[model samples]
Target: MELPVGGHPADKYQNPKTMKTRVIILLAIFLSAFALLPDRVIKGTVTDGSHTPIAGVNVSIQGGGSGTVTDRAGRFAIRVPNLARALVFKKTGYKSLTMPVTSDSVLNVALTQATLKTEELADQILDHSKQPGQAEKSLAFNRVAAAPATFSGAVMQMQVPTESYKPINENGFLSVGQQPVTTFSVDVDRAAYSNVRRFLNSGQMPPEDAVRIEEMINYFDYNYPQPAGEHPLAITTETTDSPWNPGLKLVHIGLQAKTVSTENLPASNLVFLIDVSGSMSDPNKLPLLKQAFKLLVDQLRAEDKISLVAYAGSAGLVLPPTAGSEKKVIKDALDKLEAGGSTAGGEGIELAYGLAKKHFLPKGNNRVILATDGDFNVGISNESELQKLIEEKRKAGIFLSVMGFGMGNYKDSHVETLADKGNGNYAYIDNIQEARKEFVQEFGGTLFTIAKDVKIQIEFNPAHVQAYRLIGYENRALRNDEFNDDQKDAGDMGSGHTVTAIYEIVPKGVQTSYIGTTEALKYQQNHVRATGDSDEMMTVKVRYKKPDSEKSILFDLPVKAATLAFEKCSENLRFASAVAEFGLLLRGSEYKGKATYADVIQRARAAFGKDEEGYRSEFVQLVKTAQSLDGSQETARK
Candidate 1:
């Protein structure tokens, strides 16, 4: 037979150099055939902060819309039009990179690893491990990380990569990769692990249920105080016996943050502090944020004035204080913003607050809306400095509202603190819909402050109730002393925003006990006490200061009999409880007992009252994704 036109399979396989040369020749010939045609080849390598190669990275040309993944050697190549301007590189667990495609085809990119706290790792381990007990152990280790250190004061840093790593023992040591092995350790007393195990076995997780209570109360759509006059703030409390732990009763408290509308509302002087940093170049960041603000701009009246300040490596006032009626001017200023340069967030806040004070509208809704990824690279990099700065600004009568955007390098803790100190609200905008929920749909409630330093304190009648736990306010809980302190600011409630809180209670004479009793009160008198016989269980107390007031007004609502039917309560309570349980699981709270995604979904589905916004349905999807992640983690753990 005649020799093959090209070459034998063995020849092509064995003589790889010759085969490569032949392929190159063919490609060159093909390009030469179309001499005038414009073509380009963009190639780059992706590496970690340490300059170590990271394989399987994704590289894409922005406008060209073509993409490829890097090989084992971290090299990626993509063919594009010669006029192709730039390319973007992205990978999980690392900051994305983007660069212009200049004459040099070879480009090297370094991606910074995202920071993860031990608590976050615990969440990941619980959600991603494949084994049954592994998640529980990882959760225990995380708790140990948070325990008070009995040894030296050195901070123990822990890193759990998105990719799975080997299991860590009680001593807190794990290895990953062959070349650069990573290790972690936490300060644990001799009996710490055993103590934690005992606590778990005793079913005594932290009083996390109390924490959730505050968040649930805060998350409701409460009616706010109108600018008209002082009115009686109303909150309704409904309770029922718990199904899981019959000894504990479930109480739902709903607060309506309402304000009577006055003929003349206070004039609002608002400053829009926007981040134009390079990291915010993503469509979801600056573009979506701009769109979200436009909705708010449309809701503004003639009494309102808005100023714009933008920062990226430098801070500048893009627009002078202008009347809300001048929509064109504001829109043009917003449209001119372009993302580039490093983030100078601290400077941006300073400039924005300065502008707000310059045009301060006393007795009005004076506020600075800070929208960013919470990434401050320039001066005042520490959270304390930023917090102090915000505190000082708040003294000038301008409140702060923090809107967090994007994903990588998101500083949730920092944003939350800033909002807390500035006497404002904090919200994360994950999509345009949430933006509408924050800005357009809830414009007045979002921008106007009805009540400030609002705190809830409920004293249960020990005779009627045995024990109680609040749900979902782990970070927001105020110390008992901080409750009455006027200077100690808490959360703000907006007009029309509802706040709901749940407390699980146990009735006296019940056979079960959720919490162990401290040796019965010593030396108490044995005087015969009359039993009221009323079904009343507890009295709820709420204290709040007017937006401009220093002292707080207290309100009380008494909850009497319990209801067993879940059908009587609004869907909001049931749906909120599901989310609360999900958060508890993510934190691996000691309180979680036999709670699963399945339970959450079932509860949510049953209580999913007219979900016109579809938030409840979306919650189901999130639960599913979390469940899948949990399954994967279990597998890995095994």
Candidate 2:
């Protein structure tokens, strides 16, 4: 019963025009104030009480719907209403934090570790165990739930770990007199490094099978020459003394693809195949997935196109092929996604591939990026069918890029197999920073393929090198005959990608006990040694096909013997040596001669040359952590 603004109580009762005018004036004032309350992007870093960055922390605007999670680097960027009062930062086993909203663009937060309750541990632990023929991977959800892990100031969880990793037997020495050729398919995937890091960070030693040394070595960028002529890749070689053993030589082979600037990169027609199953209900899986993809959406150009296909109990196209310029629309769809129901990943793949083909761009990037925890229950039955499907689709010129998320029930074998057969690469996104690295920082290298079916064959001169063993890549080994078969499938390299391989070699004159004498056959005399190529240690031959071509081109380089001391080797060799040595210790390889955590720490510190992203620095920290844990009495080495 109050009088209208600017009108007496009696006049308000007598004049309807005055009341209407007042109502319009008041509405204009309210709208003006509301329009002035624009959204602002807030950037920040979250850390624990120790000041170490904490990944996977949920950051949300209080009383607002917008939210995001911290990346591996503990950094996050979120858009919030200007009038928001506070932000809530939360992570399991950490005390929840709420800080008043401020005008500052950067907000740094630190949360203290909390004593975890049984329910908390039950909800937080990420474990997925698999046994052969048991279908543990596909049947993970149906089994009874496991117990919670013991907590100790959040240092390490005491629980039965269930992550799946295929058994990897370290390669041993091969006498050049018997086998003179070393061949392997090139592998550009780096998922192993991040996955292994996750294990260490969780205070557990990574299962030996999870350590793919070639993938680890290739994760970091090394300075190498670019392709000069018709080839899309350039080669570099280095040799030095092996750090683990005396008198043994180590050879480094590096391939660097030509760098194509963003402006010159081809238009992209992309399909985002996502998993929204009940297993992905974990915050790190589906929720983090949505945020991770938003980073890619932000990088899209007007010419690029994006489509989204989500699968759970079934598969459906959430967003049709739309221009990348419609970023808001794409991101809105991403934001609306929720996790529930069983996974029908196989059907999702078919739909995604079909869409990619339908919108396929000739002479451009046509790809399907699958985001999932690798739990495909309803759709794909076994890998044989999955591989056959992906392989067929890839032949249609639509490549796959797998972005693995979540932990429990993760089917790494399936992820790796899909990437391998589909002529693509795989990466595990443990946090938001890693997503940015994939979708923003290494945008070109993650999507655009420059070469396919890339393979390497090295002919060792027995006269100079007596024995050699490839440091890693047990799974990528190819039959010598397969190298020459153009129809054989191999790893594909992306633009600006680098692949490195190392070999531990024993010289002809070096009397190494590891290469025990092989008795000559009584019926067949040992083949005579060929010394014609004694001038060179090995001839490194490479074969690769263009993105659109079926025929592969051949190239070769004769590498002379290296005489540099281990300490005097190039930074590339030294760093690679450091990483390889670390892998050796992690895998507990029989060949980890004289390798110690101290040596790895020192060597990595010296080679932390151009770590612009702090990855090398993080490696050093992980090594130190492993050194600490492995030294604990409970984990004493034999």
Candidate 3:
């Protein structure tokens, strides 16, 4: 018989050498299959270059059906098909990475941090034109993120109400009174320092009356740490001059609110304060609110309890406090709610608080979740009385969370105040996804309070800096004394919440100061503390009271490094800065420089981070809408 070279029946009858070759061939096949099986076991660790584990990173194989998120340790394991040649990794705040599978079944991958660039910021500002029915006089900005920096930047456009656009004061500050919306576009360069010092020293800008766009932007996203543990909160601030105008510079800051595990959250007591008034008869109003509530109902745990209250001319208990485990009962109550009569929001709130108080679970999550258009037309309609009632109820330890719905008559002012006074948070539910964000995705943080009365006080070293101004938080600004006052209630931060603020600084050696010294301050003798070290820029102090407590905790951090180059900041910080500038322009802020929509877009484009969700891209579209509205208004005026 002929000798076989590889595994064959003939090899049995062949010589010893042929038989040995046949055995080797069979062994090779078995080893290959074993090797393939090990590759099928996909494994990797999601981490930053700094060797820090990044949880919640999503991992999936290209063209494969299954995916998994990184665990608390930033480790992930998935069973992929043996045939798969590669896999992809992604996360919201981190860049997405795709890798080819190698012989080692175990893989260690480091994901680069996601950031926005200058051009990306610009693109976002220009893209805002796509918003529906954007008026010709609308104001808009572009937000972009950059690498290594934590915040984003914005480019803005101002639509001048009249042809004669001039600052009322010779100083940089714009007068608060009404001015014709002017169409002016300038790039707001990123600022290297914080603006808080400017506000404190100048006192030219009115407190409480002015609205900082950054605060409005940061307020809705409640990402405080969980009650169980400390969460890492990061913030970056930057400022640069307008690409179109050297005289103007924009300031931007980015904040990242880290989330803790939900394993230790306490059971919740949620009271639904629904508004089923005559105005809510539209399908999108009452019906949408009903649907939204149902979605929230689905997110509840078995240990959680819920109650229902409806208001129109009067308020009534639609459902008593019931266990979340009983879904059908809650759903039935929600289904039966009907809309009629004039809005009696005050009465509704009183009744809702009564129910919440009755069902209060000490040391547990107790909150009245109010859903309404914020229109109150019946008895006790005064905002002061309503504020007083909510403030008093807050003392009872029952928190308030407001969900704003509908337009045309939306009471942003009232809703904002109620949330602030009630030691809770507010959200605007324009769509189902937003509802999910507030109710489903961030359920624990939305309901529970890890920290309350959170406040930040940064004392800049006058030796290293000449002038500074806080970018936003115009309404939240506090006097140096307010920081120590436990009775003075500040902003309430929920679980896994992160708050960020920024300031623009004019270094001592800079040619000119954006903020001039006040007459009174100039006349007064100044005391200066000189530090020889140029590295120490400022000292940051953060103070907060634990939820349900009166005592405050304080933390101090020193900013020792000199100002970072404009290009060095991360994309997120750059993009966020653009957004701040745009917001300032929209509010007609006194500090707004030569910021414009086109400049905002260009900066956003350069710093556009890994925008998997397209939020940054959508912001660009909004800017375009604002620009079109501004142009049309100017033409009509002509």
Candidate 4:
């Protein structure tokens, strides 16, 4: 190098060898700056063995010095140096794949989803595990609540990945004299229970709103008697001292829909409206959904007809009307679904409903089964808009069932609303077992509706009950007059389905601050045939319409005021109360009273009758896990 400059930094190097070293340092610095400017850009989509795009995948150059995450559509763009030799793609619960860099600018790669060994999964779920995080992420899913503040409170909610839940205000006691009539639509959705299990199993407490006490209690089966006559359902009631509050009385009301065997079921005209948006790339979402549909396919008979429609950037029909016997066609259509683009849920609904109408099945089950995380963003994604579309479809005699999958951006409020408006049911699938339960074991109850617009109205006798508070069903409450309105839409009861509701009542003479005294209500007793001297506590009235009927029928049952000790109550009451107590603890309700996780666990285990499929037993285990995570002690009222 020629040193001819004036007083300058580089001019200070006079020795030839030193000058060479200086030149080398300058070259290194120049290369470092150049490294920041990549020489090439590579783009590709990551997918699973089924050729479905995999979202949230980690894409990086070999050795991981630089990386980018795949977007909602499983597509990623990375800038790399010309010398970069290979790309590494990895995701949790999937076999990592590394591919050599080629001259091609676009390279699409597929990964093989790996199944963790049973030992590994079991070790993670059991109490005292060292890696609860790993098990939850690989199995169900792992999501932490959004932080409350940025760079401050535990969770910066606005900045973190978050799940959605409609906030709940716990129901409080109402004086029987002031408000004796309680009316509500029966809810059959079990999403809240499994979703709660997802949270507790991941070594974290579920957010309060996620705990719907009624859903938790209804998740298990109760031995309510089947209808003994021409009616489609039977109603039963029992009262016992509360497990959480001995001073209070727990009233259990159950309605069981008669079971219809598969052979006797009507033909179904099904429309599968799937959300193949990038957000659905999780293994638990799309892959698991495909598997669940296969189970439904396996149960299909010759009379059933099915259609498939999917939405991403836009909506389109993937499969036209085809007989359920053509399994390969449906499975192939499902297999080729690759998640990408924005969600056009509204468009998807319109198209699916159109198809359902085109192949209308009179006297058959016509339903649009919507599977999505409910992260609608593209067009008409608002809850009210979607509800409007479903409402319009409802008029056409098309029902909709919503299947919620995955988390972290899940629109739970939207899912529930769509199902409610469509006059159908909803379920959240956190794992394959739940999928099996929804699509296989409860096949009839999941798809075939036996009764619709089912509503319950109960009138408490002021003489026997001073005050009463209904547990859960806050969202399902209706105006007292809506009970007998045939035009009003309520809830649908599927074949072999059961619904339960609990009430905490304060007896007339015994009271310990549950419901503060009210003077006017005391003097104004419900005097219209109140049965002042009778043993009747409350009268249960049910109104419902046949699945395809336009009119409603009414029936009533009178429940006795006799109360049993918690120990003497039937297994149904004990187990359901245990679940309710657990919900109170999870929700931290003001009315939790003397509730404790320890009591819930003990009560649940004692009432774990037969547990043929081990669901109740699984519930006990989950309670144990929750107790461990909650740091609950053996004592009551933790």
Instruction: Estimate TM-scores for all models.
Output: 0.65, 0.83, 0.64, 0.76
lDDT, candidate 4, 1-638, per-residue tens: 55455744464555788789999999999878877775798999987677756555677899756676664356788887777899998764466799999989998999885544435334334432222111233233332321111111232111113466788988999987788899999999999998887665443557777888888887888899999987898998889887777778899999999999999999999999999987788656777788778888888888999999999999998999888889888889898998877799988998999999999888899999999988888888777888888988887789999999976567788898899999889999876667878998999999999899999999998788888889999899999999978888899899999999999998888867767776664445458345788888899999999877889999999998898877888899899988988888888788999988788889989998877876887686567656654542112122
User: Can you write out model 3's per-residue Cα lDDT over 1-638, one digit (the tens) per residue?
Assistant: 45456645573465898778889999999878866774367787877888866555667888776666665466788777766778899754366798887767788899886555446534443443332212232432121112222324332223211111112221232211111011110101011011111111111111222234554345333222223335334444455543333444334433344454665788888899999887666544676687778888987888899999999988888998899989999999998988888888998899889888888889888899999877778967898998899988888888898877653344556676777788887776654544566677777767777667766666655555555665555445566777777787777655566555555555555545354543323322232323544566566666667666789876655676444455776565566666665566545555565778787777767766776544455455445434543443344345
Per-residue lDDT for 502-564 in model 1, tens only? 665556665443456444443321311232465666667777887878898876667776675
Number of the top candidate by TM-score?
2
- Number of the top lDDT candidate: 2
In candidate 3, which residue ranges exceed 4 Å CA deviation?
A: 1-212, 219-258, 511-513, 517-529, 532-534
lDDT of 4 at 334: 90
lDDT of each: 0.62, 0.82, 0.60, 0.80
TM-score of 1: 0.65
Error of model 4, residue 52, in angstroms: 36
> Tell me, what's the RMSD of every candidate?
15.8, 6.2, 16.2, 14.7
Error of 4 at 8 (Å): 78
- Per-residue error for 428 in candidate 1, Å, reads 0.7
Error of 1 at 312 (Å): 2.6
lDDT of candidate model 2 versus the reference? 0.82
lDDT agreement of model 1 with the native:
0.62
